[model samples]
Target: MPGFVGAVQIMNIGSSGVFHIGDVFQLTPISTAKTFAGAGSFNTGETLTIRNHQSATNTFDNDGIDQGNNFNL
Candidate 1:
């Protein structure tokens, strides 16, 4: 990918389901919700930060996440 910068930065995440890192998310004109390939659970409205995106694995790193930190995709 030309001019590829880094992993995407996400913040202030809240979901009705147990949406966690690694799980792909979707944003539509209606609302936001977890899509395919999610493997974490959390209480409603539990905010989390994820790094190290692996689309093939369909997961991301949720450990030791810093809001401003970035990792390879």
Candidate 2:
């Protein structure tokens, strides 16, 4: 799911379930979570990504962003 930076934005998440980067943001399994601080369970091998707007270039920084790997479940 190749998406342009800053081109996409999350409007909302439904009540059926919570949203995740890979689930709602249309990101790949390896992508890291860029926003939304929370403690939620995820499956193993699952990954997520988020944008880091605080950077100078406003680009997606792999180090600045948060990542979830090696899930407990």
Candidate 3:
């Protein structure tokens, strides 16, 4: 069987807000930083789904990344 991933909700409180996916979440103020702090663990060969808050559509699918590969920082 295949594993599964779900949608993520991110809110922008600042004017220069931009969303990103990373191995872990970061508290830095850098705009080019890759943070995955909110990510969870998952198994291999998993089917992951990523969606945007603005639209009710899924943006990414079957990312093929292991749960331990990266954090949602």
Candidate 1 regions exceeding 4 Å error are 1-45, 57-73
lDDT-best of 1 and 2: 2
Q: Model 3, stretches more than 4 Å misplaced?
A: 1-5, 23-73
Kindly give the stretch of ten consecutive residues in candidate 1 with the minimal lDDT sum: 64-73
The digit string of per-residue lDDT tens for model 3 on 1-73 reads 3445589876656754655555544644434333333233232466867544453434354775534524434
lDDT of 1 by residue, 1-73 (tens): 2354467766655542333345345623333333445434332455766543643435555675534313311
Model 3 clashing-pair count: 14
lDDT of 3: 0.47
Q: Which residue pairs does candidate 2 place in steric collision? A: 31-48, 31-49, 32-48, 32-49, 33-48, 34-50
- The TM-score obtained by model 1 is 0.16
Worst 10 residues of 2 by lDDT: 35-44
Residue 67, candidate 2: how far off, in angstroms? 2.2
Give the lDDT of residue 8 in candidate 1. 70
